[model samples]
Target: MVEPVADQVLRAIDQVRERYYRLIVIVGPAGSGKTSALQAVSALTSAPMINVNLELSRRLLNLTERQRAIHLPRILGDIVQETAAELVLLDNIELLFDVHLHVDPLRLLQRLARNRTVVATWNGTVGPNGLTYAVPGHPEYRRYPTGDLVIVEAKP
Candidate 1:
């Protein structure tokens, strides 16, 4: 069965479709239904959604941490080709930020968002622009940035 998309996530997807390279961040306290909301959106849009768990795949890979950044796009590319989900979702983005990296995960996300739409679930905000990043250390993350990322948390 398809999940119900929250009003905010629905609105975010609508906004992203209107604007290219849109980066939107979804932030909330733990167990606050962040992942649920993302799932709902994915179902609502019928876009293949991938919940990229930060703790599991990004860190456990056997390759060097630096290579993760370089490798991530390839992995994502495979997934995109396999699934062909127009909208991509990255869940639990905290691990990507906290881990020591050879490549910037933010760049990868930005690069992916360049053409297709990406809805990422982050722990907090990222930089001031472009990347749809979570606020650093805010523990409330949801971003869709198109060169200038300005997040306004909605009441879900």
Candidate 2:
């Protein structure tokens, strides 16, 4: 039997405890149950789940494009800090990939994980090139080397 995504993420959390950046990214396509797995992990571990797009959008609503780009990292850090949880689950991170944001999505997550464990749902795939979001030639396309990040695949 295939191991459940939540279980895989839970195991990853434990495994990254001593790492500099305690981040576990759950990668899958749309409708792949990444959110459900994150919910399960949240319920099981009592960690707070954050909707990144909603929260970040709300916080950046009144900011100018330049302001948003300038303050994005600090805003994100504040959001994570507000959770006050050792482990934070983030979903709907598509906003972070917006070209206007002028920020590296994976690096933002890594920065957040420096202070606490972060398990985030990534609507993407892990390939030989590394973790990818969207596709080449797409406005939001992004790819990053796996580096020290732990990854959990959520298949439907």
What are the per-model numbers of colliding residue pairs? 21, 0
lDDT for each candidate structure? 0.58, 0.93
Candidate 2, lDDT over the whole model: 0.93
> What would the per-residue lDDT of candidate 2 be over residues 25-65, giving only the tens digit for each residue?
99999999999999999999999999999999999999999
RMSD of each: 5.8, 0.8
- What's the lDDT for residue 42 in model 2? 93
Candidate 1 lDDT over 9-55, as tens digits, reads 66666777766565556655456577887777767777666656533
Which parts of model 2 have CA positions greater than 4 angstroms off? none
Return the TM-score for candidate 2, rounded to 2 decimals: 0.97
Worst 10 residues of 1 by lDDT: 146-155
Candidate 2: worst-modelled 10 consecutive residues by lDDT: 147-156
